[model samples]
Target: QQPVQSPQAVILREGEDAVINCSSSKALYSVHWYRQKHGEAPVFLMILLKGGEQKGHEKISASFNEKKQQSSLYLTASQLSYSGTYFCGTEMAGSARQLTFGSGTQLTVLP
Candidate 1:
């Protein structure tokens, strides 16, 4: 099943911080985070594995809790360039490894 993200949209000023959450009903093996600007394809942000292994930039951090089957994206010191639509893709355990993305969270950073 596709994961569900909270706070479908958020507006932040430069240097602000925000948190986006993704929760799935099924067991998750990995959670992938991507950001897509308007008129552009989604760009990979990070991936969190079931064992708490993380691969991504330091500016963007995420956590995956196997027990809760949930993940959260932490956007720190937000910048205007950060404005975009964020999506969380989920890979369920015992599945084909196909990623099912959440609806999306629109983040707008104002100067």
Candidate 2:
């Protein structure tokens, strides 16, 4: 099943911080984060695997909890360039290994 993200939309000012969450009903094998700007394809952000290490880029970071089957994206000191729609793609065990993305989280960063 596709994971569900909370706070469908987020409006932030420059230098602000925001967190987006994703949860699944089944056990997760991996969680992938991506961001897509208008008129562009989604760009890979990072991926978290069960019992694997977490990763971060710039001021963005993410964590995945295998026990809870949940993941969270943390954007710190947000910038105007960070404005985009974020998606979380999840992989579940015993599945086809296909990734199913959450609806999306619309994030707008204002100056």
The estimated TM-scores of all candidates read 0.94, 0.95
User: What is the TM-score of candidate 2?
Assistant: 0.95
Clashing pairs in 1: none
Report the C-alpha lDDT of model 1 over 1-111, residue by residue, as the tens digit.
678998899999999999999999998889999999999999999889898664547667888888888899999999889999999999988889899999999999999
Report the poorest 10 consecutive residues by lDDT, candidate 2: 47-56
Model 2 lDDT per residue over 9-70, tens place: 99999999999999999888899999999999999999999984577999999998888888
Alpha-carbon lDDT, every model: 0.90, 0.93
Off by over 4 Å in 1: 54-56
Candidate 1 has a TM-score of 0.94
lDDT agreement of model 2 with the native? 0.93
Question: What does the lDDT come to for candidate 1?
Answer: 0.90
Error of 2 at 46 (Å): 0.1
